[model samples]
Target chain A: MSLAHKGLPFDRNRVSFKEIPKLENGYSAKVPIIRDEDKLIADSFAIALYLEDRYPDRPSLFKGEGGRAMARFVEGWSQMIIHPFINVVILMPVHDLLDTPNQAYFRESREKIFGRTLEDVAATRDAKREAFTASLEPIRKTLLSQPFIGGESPLFADYIVFGAFQWVRVLTSYKLFDAGDPVQDWFERCLDLHGGVAREIKAAA
Target chain B: MSLAHKGLPFDRNRVSFKEIPKLENGYSAKVPIIRDEDKLIADSFAIALYLEDRYPDRPSLFKGEGGRAMARFVEGWSQMIIHPFINVVILMPVHDLLDTPNQAYFRESREKIFGRTLEDVAATRDAKREAFTASLEPIRKTLLSQPFIGGESPLFADYIVFGAFQWVRVLTSYKLFDAGDPVQDWFERCLDLHGGVAREIKAAA
Candidate 1:
């Protein structure tokens, strides 16, 4: 979304869970490794900082130093708060969507990480759903005050969080939020941006 | 904390739950209401913005518009996320710290808000501790990457969160974070700032 926001066109290099990228000198097993001509950057936050610094004339990912820091906090919130909860809620659906080998790898890895079978995780999600939604209070409340996490306009912070919602939306038909939820409203607004690239994705039927 | 960061001196006017101040023109009853010369501002975020706009030459709380928006998100996180969790942990202790009449007001208000007695709330703290700490993962993870939520230097974002911690700290001997946690480290670092004003506050024995 930040890349799209910058209007920077690039070739898609979507890799699976087991595929590790061979860098010029070494290897990084991350999906978000970006190669900007000669420069290579790994990690989303670092990539955001690199893009902001490299393309000073383009639309900014961060407004300033303080913005950059707060965006990092948002990134942390997404990783720690949003992604974990979303992952549990949509685990089995996501597995079914993947190729057989990738599905096995996904189940094995997630089970190892969570210490529970995919079925077990899914079974408990019903009990945990209320707490999970309650955890979104910050984002919901933030959206109540502003249109986007990036103030009036969208920035990297919006993308970081939206990515979490998109992750779940593309895999499951399960409703994480109720009708008329402010968060659901913001998610819709996010999906509507950049020619609706996020909304255009094929989800589980 | 932002006030101290900006080198502004303030006369503290402590108000309890029942004490609502009568303003000159109208009555807006909230704490942290600052009388800045002829202008009176209520709420911490509004006050920060007013101070930043009013005292342009002073140290900035937010670096730019993005920072301001992100700080508001942090404020929402503190209010919605941190405050509620901490309130559960320290409600009884907080009541113990208040004056007799104020304690009655605090208990009555909190009971109404939470739909439970203060003792009942505190009783569940033991079981809720793990989930509460898990919620702090965002702050912990962010601090792992950066010194403060506002980045290298303390900004209003840091104060927004630190205020939540400080609120619980001054009223209770109950330790929220385990020793060696990154959030605990950041809280200590915050205490070390502004000439340790946060650290200097006397906790309830």
Candidate 2:
């Protein structure tokens, strides 16, 4: 999204859970390792900083000064609260998409993080739905005035939060937010950005 | 703090709970009302926006793009979590400072907000302290990489969070943060800002 937001054309390299650790000749054990010319940057927030510094001429990811720092706070909030909830939600849908070895790897790893078996976690998703929506107080309150977290237009902070929302949207058809929710409205607006790239990236069949 | 952050000079107008509604001939019934020439801004966040817009030649309250929006997010997060916690914390200490009529107004209004008697709320202070600290996860995680929430220097976002902390600091000597906690370090850094004006303001006897 940051690259696309910057108008930088790139190729998508899809790798399953098992393939992530084997990338870049043992350079990283993580996915999202971006190779820009000779520069290989990994991790989303690190990549945001790298892009901001390297592509000063490009459209900014963190527009304005307090942007990067506040973006970090947004990332922290989304990662700690929102992303964990989505992780529990996407478990089964993701497992269904994985090949056997990857599925095994996925369940074992994800169960450790969630501290619950996939079936057990899925059992409570219905009850947890409202809790997830209620937890969006900060973001919901933020959009009460501004059109985006980055103010008039989307910024890196918007992408950080949208990544969490988009993660759930691409998986199950389940409703994470109620109809007419400001966050849901923001998500739709986000999907409409970058020439509808977010919508163009089709959800799993 | 926003005024101080922008290097603007101001006089403090301390109003009692009962006296607040009388400010500016009932123009606003709120504390933190700023009378900047002809502009009478009521809310804290609104005052911040007013200051930023009115004093463009001054040091920027929000240094870069996405700043105002991200600051709103920071304000939302702090108000929802931190400020409410401090409001509960300072209930008794604030009550202690008021005279008879003001004390009656304070207790009645605050009790309505908390939905509990002051004594009942005071009884749970020790238990709630750790919970308040636990809620600082986003701010703590942000401080892990950057020195301040707005990056190298403190911005309105830092002051938004610090306002809550400072409220507690002024009314009581009770330690809100544990020693050597990253938040404590950040609070001290905030205290040291603008020639230690936060410290010079003095704490309750």
Candidate 3:
């Protein structure tokens, strides 16, 4: 959505390890890669920041000091809260719901890394979810009072948070967000600005 | 040391909360406030960014795109890894060692919020520390290959990571970090830049 908003030529391709030849470096890579001219970049945040920096003439994804602080706060808070919470509850279960081979691999990976049973993982996940949701109250209160996180204009903070919240909404069927009237209006404004990419993604999913 | 390096005034007195009256708004009314007359800012990151923004004549703390990405990555990683790890292993124990009424209040607040016993928190913390340290292999590799995190120049990323690592060094006797020769040399360079302030803080402790 943000990529499209930045007016960049974004090519979305789904590739697997089998599709690519082995590198001389001995790493079998089958990840999403973004190419702008000769520059090939990896990592979501890295790509986003790179685009923002390269196209400063276009409308910015970040603003001034307050905007930067708010964006950082939201991004940092999401990593602290939403990422871990969603990983435990939604992603783990979704991985299990996949085919037998993938599920077996997932289980083995979880056991090897976390050293916990499926049931134990689920219980711990639930606890984290509860704590994360409770922690969102402060953020909710702050958002309720503002049109956008950084005041009147919607920025990258909204997109980053909205992305996380969308995943939670899809997985849990929970509407744990209420950014109040101004924020609600600002969200619609963002969708309009991004040429309804948010709606398109949500509808597709 | 960051405060000192910026040539800001520091409050000399450390007064008890009992000496001040509480605000009707339920927030701190008479708490000690660190002030910079030139720029009115509160948060450390805000202050750092503000200094970078305002003092264009001085070399920027955050450089360009790669520098910004490096800073954000380090900032996010430190919050995700270092803070929680040190809080559980070193901070909680040290708080207990202090055995102050304020420390007890802090423990109670954490318990009520996170719903974990101190020992449980500590163990969970240790596990996170191990995982974080293991994950740092790639980051260490990157740092070892460069003079600073953003290449030859020390950016905001260096300072942000340094602050967290400094805390760990202070609170615990554990020697967990080794980013090879270049990183160690960079660390010494940052300490040298900060001058006697770092030494003074350590001496005070």
Candidate 4:
């Protein structure tokens, strides 16, 4: 998304979690390692920052320094509230999509981290149903007055929040928002960004 | 804060909830109304925006429009999570500070709004203790890298979050942050802003 928003096209590298350690001969223990010539940057956020700084003339991600900082808070809010909910909701589905060895690896790693089976974790989604919806109050409230979290047009803050919905959209058919939800409107608008780029990828049933 | 942060000095008008209806001959029915010559602005946030736009030459409250929009999300998070907790924690203390007539008014109004007595509401502080601490995770994560929410220097986003803590500071002795908590460090830095303006008002004991 940082790359897409920046108008800098790049080839995709589909490395599994098991392959993250071997990238660039143990350069970083992360999935989002981007190789630009001799330089390799890891972490989604660091890559966005790097792209923003390294390519100043391209379309900006943050728009300004203030957006750069506040985008982190949005990230914190999303990761703390939205991601945990969405991750659980799609856990079983995600596990189903992986190959046999990777599926076992996924289950093992996730179970160890969560201390719960995939079925048990996904079951917890119903309990967190109300909270997951309520957690989006800030985003709903913001979209009431502005077209995007960054205001008027998309910025890093909008991208930061849209990433969550985009993730949920591709992995599961679960309806996270109500029919008239402001977030639903915002999500559609996001999908249409950069000439209907995100919408091209059909959602997994 | 919008006034003080903008290097603008203004007189304070202490109006009780009962007296809010009488302000400007019933022009507005809320607190934090700023009168500039013939114009009257209501709502703390609206007043801040008005000040930011009106006083362009003075120090900016938001620093930029990005901060302006993102500040609302910070406001949303604070009001959603922290405000509920702190309001309950300081319910009795705030009621105690009011005169007999105002105390009855405060208790009646608040209890009606909450559907519970001040005592019942304050008691909820204990149950929400863990969640309240956990809610500060985003702020904790942000401060680990930056000194303030807006990064490098304070912006309206910093003020938006700080208002909740500052409210608790002056109204009650309840410690919201543990010693060495990053939020505490940030709160102290906020208190020291504009020549320690917030600290001049001693805490309620």
Number of backbone collisions per candidate: 0, 4, 0, 0
Question: What level of docking quality does candidate 2 show?
Answer: medium
CAPRI category for model 1 = medium
Supply the DockQ value of model 3: 0.07
In candidate 3, which residue pairs get closer than 3 Å at backbone N, Cα or C atoms, i.e. clash? none
lDDT of 2 at B139: 84
The worst-scoring run of ten residues by lDDT in candidate 4 chain A lies at: A11-20
Model 3 lDDT tens row, A1-205: 5587587667676443344333323333533356788777664555657777889777666653233333443565566556766666655545645677666766776677768865677678644655565555434444444445533555676676667655554556443434453434554665665666665545212
Please provide TM-scores computed only on chain A for all of the candidate models, following their numbering.
0.91, 0.95, 0.71, 0.94
Interface RMSD for model 3 amounts to: 9.7
> Distance from true position, residue A159, model 2, in Å?
0.5
How high is the lDDT of residue A202 in model 4?
86
C-alpha positional error of residue A41 in candidate 4 after TM-score superposition, expressed in Å: 1.7
Q: In model 1, what are the clashing residue pairs, if there are any?
A: none
TM-score of each: 0.91, 0.94, 0.53, 0.95
Please report, in order, the local distance difference test score of every candidate based on alpha carbons: 0.82, 0.86, 0.55, 0.84
**Cα lDDT tens digits for candidate 2, B56-142:** 898887887688889989987887888777877888898998999998988898789889999898878888888788878898889
State the lDDT of candidate 1 residue by residue for B12-34, as single tens digits. 76666666655434446666777
**In model 3 chain B, which range of ten residues has the least summed lDDT?**
B19-28
User: Candidate 2, after superposition: displacement of residue B121 in Å?
Assistant: 3.3
Q: Pick the candidate with the highest DockQ.
A: 2
